[model samples]
Target: MPTSATLAQPAAKPASRRGFLASAAAPLIVPGSALGLNGAVAASDRITMAAIGQGPRGQFVLGHFLEQKDVRMVAVCDCFAERRAAAKQVVDKHYGNSDCAVYRLHERVLERKDIDAILTAGGDRWHAVMSVLASRAGKDVYCEKPISLTIAEGRSLIEATRKNKTVWQCGTQRRSNPTWKFVVDVVQKGRIGALRAVTTSFGEGPWRQTGVPTEEPAPDPEVFDYDRWLGQAPWEPYSKLRVRLWRVNWATGAGAIADMGAHYFEAVQWARGNLLELPVEYDGAGMFLKKPGINNIPYFYNVRARYRDGMLLIMDPAPKGVRYDGEEGYIHILDDGRVEASPKSILEGLPDLSKLPPPKGHWNIMAPHIRDFLDAVRSRGTTVSNPEAAHASHVIVHAANICLRLGRPVKWD
Candidate 1:
């Protein structure tokens, strides 16, 4: 129930569970599952996790984490009471127990030392700050993408993880998909000759807010913590439309370009083999909706960035995925897990695409990615989509967004 300002204070370190167990007055009866017997993961070997935010996307990703046997989801947090209750039900159902804790404030979840990692699938505004707080609390983070609202916030997250030695995984799961791996491999192997350009499509910009109530309505305090939900974002009057379409507003989200562009840009960065570098110049232009409303994001846009090596990265209002263009041929990867290459012969010598296990769904490629994060958490290793790569990819999107907003070109040193 604390305000966001009060929640900013450092959380108290959790008491050691071992100390408590040693001083117990009564002997404890342990189940076979708790002891790792009967084909169960041992209590000590399991990774305790908590989830923040349980919207549709949050619930989808949380379901994947629940599928991992080594991950024990103990808590669920959200600003919405319904979401918290629903998420707790799912967690309890998965473990067949009613012990899953639920909280309205994320700080309560972060204060628990028993939680080894935090899954942040909240709004774009909360992604960076939540990850920073979790890292400082000595918890690993698996955060959904467009991980930060701004380049500065992204850098702050990178620093926080490094300082805390936290294993952070950005939710750009494409890196773990075998299909994407194959695409990157082919491009890296020169099957496409020299990688001269990369092009990707982002959805059309957000439309102007219309057909919504003009007057601010009082929010139900018990049902939703509206103040906390707007954390770090500029204060605006309560509107269901605003909460529903937060991604279209500049305060809470960067736009369609950032929402979907982050994935495509990450792929482009991976293909270019420059996850740590930035393009020297960025130029973009977009058309804005003329309607009078809250939504201010561009409705159409075409953005371009030039790497120092003269290679280009282009993003426009097209379809969903990326294309790698080279001297000899080009390869295009769509969101539906479909792949097309020009001169078709270029795909001949590569690994047999037919042998690869087809993905369950477009976004269902999350299980393997979650597995990678859990492996890294146990081994103290790095994940495929670490903070550095995430930040680099985000920088490109943020810069392009800036260019489009400014209606001019921007340069990076």
Candidate 2:
């Protein structure tokens, strides 16, 4: 890994997998939920669980964990009272147990010894804090995407999880899917031929920042724990735009980079060998297009990450969609479907895809990822996309945001 003027310490070489695992070893402090299972039961054995930030994404995570038979929904937490109660109701209906506790603050949930694992689906700002707090409290964590707002925060989250000996998974569910895995395998194996470039396009772009319009405030305004919500960031007054669409504002979010760029940037890096300490250079921009009902400028965005090895990664939201180009041919991955090289003998020239196991069902992937974390709790196996990998992807996205904001090509340090 290399570092540039703006980046952190020069990227250090990573230890071997074995060395990394040995270094991660630490004493485990089992939560009550994990201990109560007695280590003698199967998936049928009950494992109590809790959720923090039970908003839209939070509820979805709760549902995923509930799919495992051994897991029992034990607690739900959220700053928003309405959302918290809604998640609690869902948990009760699924578990048929109304006794499960619900809390307005996440710290109370973390303090509970009965909770085995925590699903941290709070806003982007809360992602790293909740994960670090939960891990310290002896709970496995399944935190949602973009893991952190900045590269520094991501590094801290990864280190804290290792120190606490927590089995953690960043919620990039696509990583659990087989088709995407197959795509990555193809790119890594040079099936696409000396991978020269990758281009990713997210769905248009998010709303842009315009000062909020004045309006009468609600009577019982949802008094969000602004200080707690701000956590590491400075505390400030609440606004509809900040509360509803914070991603566009830098103070609360990383705009599209931390939001959408996280997904495609990760896909690109996973396809490549690894992320560079810094890119050779970066260039991109956000413009507002005059589309009906759309107020933001530059609804479209694109970035080109030039690498030292001549390999290029282009991220753009365009009509042409996502594609990877190589010396021999290219692969196009689109919403409708995937199309590999059409040249005769291309499939024949590749390694035996048939030898690998076929993809599991859609819902099956997350279950296995969850099981992988659980197994690692005892066996200490490496997670598929550990915090290190997540952080690397986050760094790339962070750079992209810098370019979009400055409206100038950024030179990586």
lDDT for each candidate structure: 0.86, 0.68
Deviating ranges (above 4 Å) for candidate 2: 1-46, 208-233, 275-278, 288-298, 319-321, 335-337, 348-365
lDDT of 2 by residue, 1-413 (tens): 32121131245587998988876795667554445454424533566678888778778777878887567777777777788779889988985668567676676777766677887888788888888888889888878887887778888898998898887877776565556666677677776688788777666555544555233343242445545555566655555544665655566666654665565666677777674344668887777534332133344577888888887878776633357788887776553334455453455655555553443343234676676665665566667667877777788888777787689998876
Maximum-TM-score candidate: 1
lDDT of 1 at 400: 88
Pairs with backbone N, CA or C atoms under 3 Å apart (clashes), candidate 2: 3-413, 4-413, 5-413, 287-297, 287-298, 288-297, 288-298
For every candidate structure, what is the RMSD over all alpha carbons to the true structure, in angstroms?
A: 5.2, 13.3
Worst 10 residues of 1 by lDDT: 204-213
Candidate 1 per-residue lDDT, tens place, 1-413, comes to 65433453456677688877776956878899999998889989999999998999999999999988888998899999999999999999999998788888787888876889989998999999999999999999999988998989999998999999999999988888889888998899999999999988874444544435254775786699989999999887888877887877789877878877778788888887878878889998988777666667887888889999999999888877789999999999887778899989999967787777564576577888999999999999999899999998898888988898899999998
Name the 10 consecutive residues with the lowest summed lDDT in model 2: 1-10
